[model samples]
Target chain A: MISVRGVHKSFGGVHAVRGVTFEVGKGQVVGLLGANGAGKTTTIRMITGFLPPDTGSVAVAGHDTLRHSLAARAAVGYLPESAPAYSEMSVDGFLSFRGTLYGMRRRDRRNATERVLGLCDLHEVRRRRVGHLSKGFRQRVGLAAAMLHDPPVLILDEPSNGLDPKQIGQARRLIRELARDRTVLVSSHILPEVEQTCDRVIIMARGQIRVDADPKELLGSLREASPYIVEARGDAAESVLRAVPGVERVEVTSRPALDFDGTAWHTFRITAAAGAIDLREPIAATCAARGILIRELRREAPGLERVFLSLIEADEEGLPSPPGRGRWPADGRDGGGSPGGAAPQSHGAAA
Target chain B: MIPAASAIAVREYRSLFRVPVGWIVIALYLFLTGVVFVSSALIPGEPASLRYVFGISGWLLLPVMPAVSMRLFAEEFRSGTAEPLMTSPVSDASIVAGKYLGACLFLLTMLAPTLIYAVILAAVSDPAPDPGPILAGYLSLVLLGMLYLAVGTLVSSLTANQTLAFLGTFLFLLIALLLTGDMAARLPGNIGAILIRLGLSTRMEDFARGVIDTAHVVFFLSVSAWFLLLAFVAVESRRWR
Candidate 1:
């Protein structure tokens, strides 16, 4: 329902979003993951026709954002960052005003306002001034305003920013419910929230897309080359562990002089390659051939947090990112060694 | 577009009355106009007339009209609500027109209570007052308010700071009033005549004399429309930046 192509936007000398391109299809809840000032909000603004792209184009439901902004905007329900609303207005009043702006009929506006109020669980506070409502209620009111017109595309920036755990959970459920039929592009710095709510994730840093993939596949790929913790007691245990076939790097994490059975126990953390098979059997065979007595051995599943941090760290260091499984470059350009070597496609379908 | 603009205007109008500032503006305006009327227009021996009342209203409305229009767009920009309003399906022209109309309506409310002065004049006069000059005087008041409100609205769109908007609008109106009244007479021949013709005081004097010239009406409307259009352009420029 949204197509953004080769978009480049700069504010003064700051290149906020640079040559970014991505598409969100019908009924897909795509998470835009980035740190602060990573161009997520700028991209969302360009797509929603709030800010025009400097050198690219954005289309919503086939209407060009710049050329047919009114039609494009009519199809979008945008919840800007911090969920700003007319704080002086009541929740119901805000929804009704939004509905009217979307050109809803009187009866339809009332009905839609009622529906969103119920959906966002804002019925009890519908009559309260929005400024007087709690932060969670204010967020729900923003969500309700966005849903009031029932637009096909919803662009939400940091929908769960200040919510407590329970409110965040409620927000996640509300997004999931809304995503049943609508196209959603939500930007957030919170990794787990995005993981729980989005089907596919697009990670951006330095105003560029670093990785884009299905969350499960992205996490699974990290799991394949996961780290291992090994502790052994023997002569040259570190050397033996380093010589193992699948072990790419081994570091002596702890080498305390503990006299266990007249031998010093040592611990090492091992990192395996992407194609590493089960290192357990190979390590075991190698350790037994030597007189190394195994103390502790376990593999650590790479969490999303690790993957996110690694990607950001690589981006900060100017290293070629480990291409996310089924990833695509944000821009069609092949610079920065993005490993999804295939030619960039115009739109991404539901994975 | 008209419906959308009207919807915005209605919302703005409702919000104005919902807050005490709106009531305060109306009360302050009526109280000032009352003081002016009693001090200047209530001549014991003369015929009941509102000539002095309408004459001073143009200057009186200068400061009051800015207060009414200062928050039209500045508050929206400050509170970050302008994002949603702009992202909505309404056109820039519609938003400007809506806000201008809303402020004009509030100014109208401020002027509505001043009608009591006319009633008192009509009731107490030995000769029932000629409704022609009175009607013309009220028309002049409304037009002057419209023009000042439009100028204030334009200033409001220029910045997110309401104080700046108020001061900017106040200075502009004050200069306009000064140029047309006192300064115009000090200038040389053609310049003096031109300045006098452009000043609101000249047109208001004609209205007080019961001369309803279409030229003056057109001038007020065109100037108001000019400022409203400028406000629209100022607002739409945000998208480019």
Candidate 2:
């Protein structure tokens, strides 16, 4: 539904968007993931025809944004960052005004306003002045205005930024429901929200796309390239498991059931081979020979959080690392940490 | 272009009615003009005229005009509401024209009640007030306000801070007003004439005296158009930056 070719935009000496290019297919939910000031907003402005790219072009629904801006803009609904709206206008008034700007008929404008108010759960507050609403309610009002015309494509920037957890969940669900019929491109710094809501994610850093892949594919790649997590039950389990071939790290867990039963039992999680090996079978066989009962022996899959951290690390290294893969081990052995190497890590994980 | 212009005009008109600032400007202008007309005509015991009324109001708009136009684009830029308007299908020229018309309509309303002073002056005076100067005076007031509104709008487009926009535009008008009298004379004769022609008070003096020179009218119209065009260019430049 949309194509952007080598789009570059600069603000004076600062390059905000640098030769970024991507496509959004019809009825697809794509998340434009990036940290603050990653040129996502700049790229969106170009695509929506709000600003022409300094170089190259952006096309929406087969219409050139620079040459046929009116047609392109008419087919796209944009929710700008911060959900800006006229404070003096009521929720209904703003939506209707926006609808009229999009050239909707009077009857259809009213109908669409009502429809979108319901879609964004803004019916009860339709008559309220926009300035009087809370952040979450204001966000819904912004969303309703964008959706009022029922445009084929919806571009939202940080749609859930100020919302509470419950409201964020609701907004995410609403965005997903919207994608069932229309193309949606949402930008956000929140990684898990994108994983749950978007079918594919375009990770951006600096002024370029770092990785663009399906959520499942990213997760699969990470599992194949990161440490595997394993758990088993045995005497001296921590030491024994740590000694197992390919085991890089091991930590102990308390069994509350055993404590309640007046007996001591321990659980250990092991990090092992990251690639071309299934440590579960070897660990199971080792445990069986050692008379250690294998209570749980499974490979832990990497979630979006891990993949996100890994990609950020890759960006810091000044290279585009494969998606779903963690930083490569320096010793050429998977799951082994090199204490001397300057491995990039998140503060959250390091703490 | 006309439909978009009409839409912006109606919306601005409604906004004026809804906001108290519009009423305040009108009421203040009327009360102040009433006092000036009474002092200049009723107290002097001379043939009554609206010449002094136009003189005071034209000078009064130096501050008042900026107050009204300061929010024209500044509020939109601050609130980020300019995005939807800029991103819409309407051209920059249409937006500038619509806003100019809106401010002009407000100027009309402010000028409308001053006619009451004209009527009251005629009723109590020995000689009826001259309608010729009154018409010319009102025209000058409208055009002067237009010129000021355009400058205020261009200043407003340069910043998202309303107070800064107001101060910046007000200072600019103050300088322009200063150039009309003793301050402008100090300059060389040719430069002084240019400044005098560009001066709000000097251009308005021709209309206030009931002499509607085409050159003066065109000057005011061009001044208004030039600032408005600058405002349009300023808004368009932001997208590239």
Candidate 3:
């Protein structure tokens, strides 16, 4: 359990984190999403008791970070960004030393080190110097050092930065497994990894919280507010579907059926208000009234990419979008408006 | 505080002996002290007393202490490990004291072999050597090392570059050492007497003459405390940044 209230941090003339506030409940895996220099690491540092906030307070498991830093730090297991480690120490020795610093007894320190080595998949290289290991292994060793104390909360800054895809997947699974009984706050720039690993998402931009919601409900609510695409195939399906009320737009396509002796099948795509009475019901009723049998009808919902871009653009343009319904530009694409249209991918995400 | 201090002390001591530079420092210190000891005590017409030998060996600390304390906090800052250590449960005083003790211990190891100088003088003397002066001289040498180490620790905390730490601390100690002796007499009236009395050479005079003055003891202790406090404050100021 962690509570951060109106935390602000600045260096020289630059404001790194500005009045950010959020709470993470026990056993919750929260992903801190942000662009480069978006204050994610700064926020993590404040929570971990490394850098005290310039203007607010952080409490970890009821211990005030400023007033009772030792207790607060005792409750936190932090893996710093870049996996910075003691170069001269071997994997086992480093973990042991970190364990001692965390106040573990020698015997318990060794036991915890052994357990974390297995959990992070670092047993094979336990005897090797940390500087001699590969980047992925070094990251794993960093993870082990953090987990060695068995702290109730884990704050990891860019934990999956340099790992390969498989290693990232392994780390994701490990975080999820660890989150079963502890709080996890993982910061990352990679959106999908957060989507795959975190239970809740906190998107930050320009030193402020842009959006915070369950990844599923957030996207679903956005989809309900945006345009819904419907495809139908039947005799005069295009006109019949377009005739229904609330059908704001329509596109028609024709394809010849190979088994039907070259008889062309008509398909219509209808775009309408999200909850306009499931346009299929009325479209089917109208088709039946016209004696045109319907073949297929399916609704295509907008993806999360649309919702995220809409929110970010709204944030950048200084526009006030709807509270829960994220605003998006019509042509869903990545930020900066690149031409080839390589946008973030989205799939079925429900709360 | 003791637990944290001991934890840091053990770590520092281990790193010193485990690395190549640690041995190199000890070897280099012994060689330099040997050269100075022979030039002052073993020369053909030089005095048989090892007083000059101990005195010059005290000057040997001018350059040696920077090597020992340059990496105290500076290397930690540069390597980024300072984050975890500073964020840990340890206090600033404990960290500074631990590092100072580590440096002192290294200086002691270097000073250990030089005791043979006193032994040689005792063996080849007209009357049995007065072990009092020998003991007092070694005590002053240790105090001088502590004073330089405190300054070096403070300098290390001021910058992350070890080279800068070395140069900064070296210059600071040199200035502090100069202000207390012949260098001070050239200045004004009462100030010159006070500076001469406080200078390393003047304070160490009683010890070289086989008399330990409480004033000199208090002076070295005060100097050690002042610099160590500065080092602690320097380290704590990092919390603001």
Against the native chain B, what TM-score does each candidate's chain B reach?
0.95, 0.93, 0.92
In Å, residue A243's CA in model 3 sits off its true spot by: 10
lDDT tens digits, residue span B9-90, model 3: 7777667776777888889888887887767766554346777767877888888888889988998889888877766666
- Computed on C-alpha atoms, the DockQ of candidate 3 is 0.39
Mind giving the per-residue lDDT tens digits that candidate 2 earns over A1-351?
989887778888898877677788998999887767777888888988888999888999999998887888888888888899887778888887787677777899889987998788888998998989998898888888888888899999889977899989889888988889999999887878888899888766667765566776656655555554444544555666776787767777555235454544566666655443667777777777776665566666667676556656666775434333334331122342322232322111111
Q: Which model, 1 or 2, shows the larger TM-score?
A: 1
Q: Pick by lDDT: which candidate is best?
A: 1
* Best model number under TM-score: 1
Q: Write the per-residue lDDT of candidate 1 for residues A1-351, one digit (tens) a residue.
A: 999888888999999987777788998999998788878888898998889999979999999999999999999999888888887888888888888888988999999988998888888998999999988888888888888889999999889876889889988998888889999998887888888899888877777776667777666656666678888886589899989998888988875567747777888889875567879889989999987989789888765677667767666766554333323333333342323232223121111
Q: How high is the lDDT of residue A225 in model 1?
A: 63
Candidate 2 TM-score, true structure as reference: 0.87
Please tell me which predicted candidate would have the highest DockQ against the true structure: 1
lDDT of 2: 0.76
Please report, as a residue range, the 10-residue window in candidate 2 chain A with the lowest summed lDDT.
Answer: A342-351
Angstrom error of the Cα, residue A259, model 3: value is: 23
Residue ranges of candidate 3 with Cα displaced over 4 Å: A222-316, A320-351, B18-20, B43-48, B119-128
Q: What are the candidates' individual DockQ scores?
A: 0.72, 0.58, 0.39
Task: Look at candidate 1 and give me any clashing residue pairs.
Answer: none
Superposed by TM-score, candidate 2 places the C-alpha of residue B195 at a distance from the truth, in angstroms, of: 2.9
The interface RMSD value for candidate 1 stands at: 1.0
Candidate 1 chain A minimal-lDDT segment of 10 residues: A342-351
